[model samples]
Target: MSSTTETVVIGAGAAGLMAGIWAARAGQKVVVLESTAQAGKKILISGGGRCNLLPSVADISDFYSGSSDNAIKRLFRTWPLEQVQMFFEYEVDVPLQLEGETGKLFPQAQKSIVVRDALQNELLNLGGEIRFNHKVTDVKKVGGDFVLACGDNVISAKKLIMATGGKSVPNTGSDGFGYEIARRLGHSNLPNYPALVPLATNESLLTDLRGISLRVEWRAEKNGKTLELGNNDLLFTHHGFSGPAILDASHWIVRDKADLIINFTQVSSEEWRQRFIDEPAKTAHAVLSDIVPARLAKALLEKANVKHDDRVGNLPAEKRKAFIDVICNYKLAISGNRGLAVAEVTGGGIPLDEVNLSTLESKKTSGLYLCGEILDVIGRIGGYNFYWAFVSARLAGESTK
Candidate 1:
């Protein structure tokens, strides 16, 4: 069906929905076009279905990891953490509870659908109409309005906002389509890569260690220099490694050809070895299984060909040092990432300089705005990405009026 509105929002994901709601509330006719059968597909699967809303301590600098530091700083100053929290709290009654070390925030009930449905309901309450299965094939400016051709219908709006997200999770409809649209509108896009995704290891030993998760520290190293270190939950998948710790480390790994070193002991090899040597009778032969999980300890020892039954007194200094070295710095060569289909977010999008930090509007194209993962701003695992989407969309909506 042909339709017209003051503002047409592309992609009914987090950013698009928020934009539609804000614009509609401002008395501007707004319509949201979603390519998928349902809205907020990514939000449904985020945080394992808990919907991480925003971090507890929303430090703007900590959230963004890009070259456009000035732009990111300016954007956050306009819509800081406190403002973001108020936006969600007023829209939805869901109370946010801060999770683990990373200030990640989740609903008190830990249900993602609650967050998604709440936002969708708010949009409806604001008189924002949503069109599902309305895949925009092309967008062009005709006269003074934006024309979006989708299937057999043509949608026209005075302003266009692209919140189509990035290449991450193609099944959820973020297939890098928005990048092409932005490029066509004279915006330079950074090379997009999968971020917050699992890493594939070249080590075949990972096969036997599948399903083993431990609280440990992982560091990415390039040219024998430590690049990044993340200490949290680390999972040993059949292919390689995953979980929060590994996912955070993947960002640094992408920048260089790095070797990931897992420190199961969470202490320096020298210190651990010295402790073991000083208390041989009490700790050395105490079975590594006693300190760590039995399965993990056994697997590590087996991989190193160190006999588990060997007593401390019977073991030589060299063997003890080798065992300590392996536990402290277990090296795994990262072959590559899991790709866009499996990534939680894309690392790059339209360059930040191409858009105004204050309004999130296109500098080259008047009345055109961009938000969410569609922009080059991407955050680490947590609610940072969601915050970026909400803040940028809010600013765009408020500025357009």
Candidate 2:
């Protein structure tokens, strides 16, 4: 006979594991099920295995939501980043450290295993049952109880929590089946896209510039407006462009389908024009090589149809203007970004309106809670996603009264 528990949490990733630990420690009969034999596969690989736990400062503005209004702002108010960090430090008993000025926080031990083991141990010591290799294939609500089918056995629970994450890396077990399960339970979905993923451009053009890394700003220009994505090192690959600038800016560029302009130097066009006018004897490439990678500097001069050895004063007015335009505003057309298979986190999922942010419970169905990447809120590159997973799960588990 299948017995019923107070809460049945599916997927042993960050959210599910955290929820079970929280619920069990609160004296509830909680059971967490994982399709994979091991839990926290993504966690094991995150932050190069050290696991970037959270950001030193996290805010509602750090995320992009598929919702109409900025409901994510309200969600953070319910469970802020500071409270979540304190939960890990004091309750989970994990020491933490801040990563320089980036505001990224990581486990002091510098191993993702520390995070995985801490949550697992806390859940087990508090009398929670976690079943591995138990894939929840189906769910049905019978009366006030929820019945979940896993292979030959069926488990019933008064409350159900789905934390199966979104499709990012398939090998880590996020296959996007979680979204299908939500749809089966009557939740609508938004289009999912690969965010925080390296972008691919014309290989022929970038062949000579592979492996070159430089710090620069990437601007997504669309219909006369320029959108500035923050500065970071831009890596030129044989296939396309990458590094911090490309990945962080990929979201906006992908959405706008805009042309990307790489600003090799921070100086404005007017400033560079005056500087070039002041230096009549300096060659175009000679001045550019000082600010940008030598190869890139040469390429920009060659692309502008100006000779590398040509003096700035000898160049024609139209030619100089064109050179200034191309150098100051080096552009590229975004082909496409890597798919969810290599993406860090999926952009869209079940709409935010489908669930109550305060409890992370589904509004369409009673006793059904959804947390983590299952929702529409996707965070920036850093530790924001994991922060959401832990907080939403912790709150969902606590609300299973």
Candidate 3:
């Protein structure tokens, strides 16, 4: 193996592999160092093995949530959606299809291995070398170039790109090692936290409602005001609620006092209460199983002290109103999130302001680039994060070329 190359890409993930492919295609000698026995472990598991390649949405603003809007804006503008799609379609030989309402792109065959194989094949075709089981322990700047020490071998390169992902999914080989490397290279890290994880609740109701799922609208409330509203599949677990809607809201709810109010009713409590009182005989004994799952309905009724056999016609007005209140707005106190183990992505990393947006090179370190989840840029669910990985790595590779 050549000890030195024009460019060295670390991590061999989506971003690192893409960078190696692009830089090598541009005629720069490139080498990729991966700690694991094989690369693309995360990619293999993403989208439940289908691999959401990219989002079909053209607008980039909908993806990110950090304070650095300008940085994100510039990064997307450099490598926009259309260009990202074309790269996979033509260069990588992976045809993509839009899966759902959010425009998430998956392989036409819905196999993640296809995407990983395609990218790796393209990189190899362009003469890129990937060193597997090479875990980089330390990175140092010696004079003008970067020297990486991995398992007794010191590899030097003209430029070093850190595409090591964040602390999420440590078993996949991302354990925030890149953050230590960045700090050693004079980059300041923002406080890292788990994002896109499940929320845990201290409430007793959730214990009985575990395994129950409902289509409901949930809103995050703080200091007597609603912070955000989301509508999607909500699930009850032994700890608390999870699913797309609950997980998405966990970011904002992390700092709160573990208290969140959920609206389980299809309509407002006041409206439902009025209707129930007006037609108690017709609705009071109505089984909630039709509106919600049988188990969930039983739990809700039990919570409201309403017997399953009690006729709506026999129910008192006050009791009917109380049932409506519990059904419409059931308050549950969230204890915490599930942490990095179950998180799909992390929230913070290398701050955007510390890196040059056009190049993805650290403002503090010359000849060093940071990409992927290692940087602070994180996206919501769907294929936004994958897009960011591709675009950011493309900019870094092109700049180094």
TM-scores of all candidate predictions against the true structure: 0.92, 0.94, 0.91
The digit string of per-residue lDDT tens for model 3 on 257-292 reads 434566675777767766666766654336366678
TM-score of 3: 0.91
Cand. 1 TM to true fold: 0.92
Q: 1-401, model 1: which lDDT tens digit per residue?
A: 23667999999999988888788777778889999999999999988898888888766545544555767878878778877787667656777777776678888889989888888998888888899999998889889899999999998999899999999889999888888888887888888888888988777767567888888888888888987777888888977889988887786776555777888878788787677667666533355676677777877786666787766555687887777877888886678888888988888778887887778889989989998889888777778889889888887777768
* Top candidate, metric TM-score: 2
For all candidates in order, the CA lDDT equals 0.81, 0.84, 0.82
After superposing candidate 3, which stretches have Cα over 4 Å from the reference?
Answer: 1-3, 58-61, 255-259, 270-274, 284-287, 307-322
Q: What value of lDDT does candidate 3 attain over all alpha carbons?
A: 0.82
Candidate 1, residue 7: how far the Cα is off, in Å: 1.1
> After aligning candidate 3 to the native by TM-score, how far in Å is the CA of 291 from where it should be?
1.7
Model 1 segments beyond 4 Å from truth? 1-4, 100-103, 282-287, 310-318
As for candidate 1, its clashing pairs are: none
Better of 2 and 3 by lDDT: 2
